[model samples]
Target: MARPIWTGVLSFGLVSIPVGLYTATSAHTLRFHQLQRGTSDRIRNRRVNERTGEEVELDDIVKGFDAGDAYVLVEPDELDEIAPGRSKALEINGFVDLDAIDPIFFDRTYYLGPKSKDYAKVYALLERALAKSNRAGVATFVMRGREYLVALKSEEGILTLHTLHWADEIRDPREEVPDLPGSRVSAGAKEMRMAEQLIDTLAMDWDPEEFHDTYRDKVADLIKAKQAGETVEKAEPAAEATNVIDLTEALRASVERARAKGKQSKGKQSKGEQSKGEERKQRTGEQSRQGKGGKQGRTGRRQGRKESGLSELTKAELYERASAAGIPGRSGMKRDELIKALEQAGRQAA
Candidate 1:
């Protein structure tokens, strides 16, 4: 079992319960050691006195603050002595609606659990009350000789505390961001509609499992490739910025591309499908065919193409035909719906 980093009493109004704080998150970043070039020797860091040119022990070090022309030195024990509640208590000042706290203020999170089973009921009561009321307890606590502003809230039947940054700590984006667009600037009506359509077409439920740290995975692959004396494929260069003149065209193309990608993703989710490489090849062929008077070519093909073979074409390919035919709500349709809609449109055209 994981050990709690801090154990203390959490009090609110007249009620108090002993609690333990446990770290809630961890990073899986790869660690690298410093090494000399063309050598097996490792490089290490040391604490050395800058003026004396000699190494110093950690025990000899004291906290120092530069005040104008001199230094104010203080011992570690002195800092502990002055901390509120001597770093043993977390007192809730008040409760506020959970939505009242801005997301930017939230920092790290910690799981807060009852220290003893005897205090479980009190902990449960507080957690359930906060969840029911959609409120969070605002509190301050001292830990590791430092004070922290935190919010206590119930999450999935347990209490979780999140450290918050002070108001002064948050930087103003207006001052930090350079040459940001102002509210006065407006996009063209056509461009705005196309961009909004693209967003709607690409909308999906939030699933963290579907996302990952691709950079970290690439680093791991690089290490394995180097160990086996193999080279890894390089990533493609980033796309250039769109010109102002091409904004509307870019937005329209983006909407179509997003719709195509959404259909492709849906195809992948089905079982016993073609390999990704084969799927890409087929898509490339379809795109190439469409690029050369695609809408005109689809019209000629639709007249001769068998209706039953419509199922053979991927959802993305069917969507292209639907787009060329100007079928309504085609972007939101499934593969079967696209086939049915396309068949009806083809018959009408005939």
Candidate 2:
């Protein structure tokens, strides 16, 4: 069962609602243990007293700030005692338009749910009211002995809290960044138009499900290949930096490429829809002959796979096939090269 990281009362004006803060996101990163190079021993870290050069227990440690001439030490109990609202109340100071806050200020996210069924109505009221007002409640509360500036907003019929970076925590980019292309730098109107056209051609609705951590998958593949005494396929090298002198030409070519990709995607989508319609018709007619229909369906799927051409597939799909076929230098192959290599491999297998 999942548990709330913190249980507290959300306060605004005179109304207070008991809420629990649950983590909204999790990472699926692969972890590895550190080990000695020549032995099977695992490498582990330990806390040690700097002055005594001896191992120390966590309970004996205290937070210290280095002053000009001395160290000021503090205990965990002192932090909790000084925490705002006794670290049990989330007091919202005021509400502001959601767009008013810059995205850079946002940090971690947490779902705020009613602690009990009795407070559900009040929680729903706050969520709906915030959604209608299109505003976020700005607030601050202490967690893990540190105070956090947060924004409370309604998302998908529920309240979500986002911890924010304090004002002074944001670095000044102008001072830190070197050779920045500021407002003084400008692109030609023709180049700008081509760039905009490229963006329009490649524009897509945000669907996170369509994307994944390919690098992590490759890492897992690498480990499995090592276990089997085989090699893993590598990806292509990144493109070189665009030349400033050929900016217009680059933009024009990019627009053309994006348009071609968009056309290919639309064509595939249309074909998929047509296939689904045909399947529905077949199922409707084969209702009386289920056994015969099952055999025909399997044969039809095999024939469909055999009939599909390399040209209909995307570059990424072609690359995957080349990788599986173990084609030499597959990583560096262009789209046309990948298709040719895969076709030859298929002919050889046949």
Candidate 3:
């Protein structure tokens, strides 16, 4: 029942379908407002001229582009004059295999629906053709004053448009990631086998519904406790294992723990549930769940690689992890201190 955000024509060669675009995703994060401490006075943001130090009116404000040592002022109408593809057309560039595109290139998704009943047949034909051919229509269009590269694919008898990242937006991981560009660390065969065993033992069905935001729930509890005039005691810090040094020993220990966890999880599953991941085998034909296990395994491997190298993380990322782990006095901690604290927190949680 969501209203369309854009009405346009989807064009390819001689075929055109009158269609509308609607956002397909939404955020559920709780919103907060800035306020003065101990009072309900809301904090408001103001745009002021830096030289005069006075609030500026909307009519007096103009967009400026940085030109080396100076700024070039531009009017709103001047932008439209240069924006070529804003002519209410979703012009198709070409069709490509849907799997050929990297997942990282996708930014946002929007549902493409027929704007009028007259174009329903055209829409259906395009959708069916894409679905049967297992392809996506690549296109470029303008929306909200910005040009976007998109892929239109058929999903469940409807067309879905996925906006993509421009080629220059993606950064080289070697430039940003630590030890990735020139890493020399190597692992023994025994250690690698043990790690694989650990992974295989821990593999299980994923039910998103089983997970909840524990920190958010705790935040809500804190608010309620404060309103009731109750003083809350700080949670005791957990003890962590720190003496282990051998890689093989660590991998062996992890494998044993994972096996134990899998055994424990067996009691949590219902009698009708499938072993390993057979439970997901009966999903609807409209969407295939066959390759999910492979995808999840790769994801787990990537996460494993990341967690095994905490020293590779930047100070800011370590600090964020510490905050999420509820490390007290983290704001006062140095970079090394945050990394050590996070390592201890991670061990305690494990």
Query: Best by TM-score, which number?
Result: 2
Provide the lowest-lDDT 10-residue window in model 3: 278-287
Better of 2 and 3 by lDDT: 2
Report each candidate's C-alpha RMSD, comma-separated, in the order given: 13.4, 8.5, 16.5
List where candidate 1 sits over 4 angstroms from the true fold. 84-86, 271-350
Per residue, candidate 1 scores C-alpha lDDT tens digits across 34-91 of 8999998999999999999899999999989999899999999999888747499999
Error of 3 at 164 (Å): 1.1
Candidate 2 residue runs with Cα over 4 Å from true position: 84-86, 276-350
lDDT of 2 by residue, 127-211 (tens): 9999999999999988888789999999999999999999999999999999999899998888888888888888878744344
Cα lDDT, model 3, residue 122: 91
Worst 10 residues of 2 by lDDT: 283-292
Candidate 1 accuracy as TM-score: 0.76
Model 3 steric clash total:
0
lDDT of 1 at 229: 100
Q: Between candidates 2 and 3, which one is better according to TM-score?
A: 2
Clashes per model (N, Cα, C within 3 A): 0, 0, 0
